[model samples]
Target: MTGSPAIPEASAASALVFVGPMAAGKTSIGRRVARELGWEFHDTDARIVAGHGPITEIFAEHGEAHFRALEEEAVRSALTGGAGRIVSLGGGAVLSSATRQLLRGFPVVLLTTTQEAVLSRTNLDKRPLLKDDPEAWGRIYAERLPLYREVADQTWASERRPKEHIAAEITAWFRANHAPAEPIHGEAKDEQHD
Candidate 1:
């Protein structure tokens, strides 16, 4: 109940990719899930930062198009990197067709939040697209909902749940629906819970 339940050794090799709108808690939930499963955790945004530069700087210097191109490349690296890991993607990571194609073989979970929740959790200035028109963030989110749905293998709304509860739900879903493959790097040991 506190963490992921024991996964049997026979489960298939698989990876969980978390996607959602800004402030939907992908990174937080992903970290929790990865910890519980004893799997590696990677964030495409973080990879983007390591590979290129800070996202804000990328957007400011080159522009949205350039930033998105980098995002696509980062996503590809994360997806093909192999199983037994949780990958958290940026809010707008789904906007690229190539990224969606790369995710085809991975189990994608969409973490969703209400528009009001999104507005409350994030400031418009930090997000390049919303800096000039804050209210437009909601509109953009509404437009992208369908796109997110189109690519999601499963959807979990994180608006009301605690992070552990959300992680538990995802863990349960993975257990019942799929098996974990041998860890691409090494076997992941189950974590000890309090």
Candidate 2:
């Protein structure tokens, strides 16, 4: 965020966040969108690895809750800082109540893909929750859909199309939905989370 877009002066709290199921191209889209807007791109999962150890190691030694706590703090720091940045959150990041509440004010874009579409791209070895089975992927997607919907400000399907196209569409959506010159601000407690 050293060199920024000419939009306006605002705190790093105004970052655009991407949330969705694993392998839904959240990282790819976030990076493209950030580049499109001349902003920095960050991935929460990568941050977790950098701050802590490997995620599976954390899950093995500490447990999911401990890993989740780390995720919560990472999400908080990412949001509280980095105004001209786009963040791709881990699939389970929104599971934290604090993360969900913190997401209330930001533009949380939910990217979705059909099970068939992601099959070729998703690496089961990397995603422990996938359990090396497509059924498990489906089940997890089903379980997280409601929570994703609850926090999403907008939704887009990341089908078999190119990543750049999806990113361009998101950029257009923001241009149409968000005020051109206004800075994205934190939500007032009196206002609705949407």
Q: Which prediction has the highest TM-score against the true structure?
A: 1
- Candidate 1 colliding pairs, count: 6
Which regions of candidate 2 are displaced past 4 Å? 1-13, 132-134, 179-194
Those runs of model 1 whose alpha carbons end farther than 4 Å from true positions after fitting are 1-12, 181-194
lDDT of 1 by residue, 158-182 (tens): 9998989989989888767764544
For candidate 1, what is the TM-score?
A: 0.84
| TM-score for each of the candidates | 0.84, 0.83
Displacement of the residue 55 alpha carbon in candidate 2, Å: 1.2
Write candidate 2's Cα lDDT for 37-98 as tens digits: 66677788888888887887888799998899899877776776645668789988878777
- Residue 128 of candidate 1: its Cα lDDT? 77
lDDT for each candidate structure: 0.77, 0.76
Model 1 poorest ten-residue lDDT run: 1-10
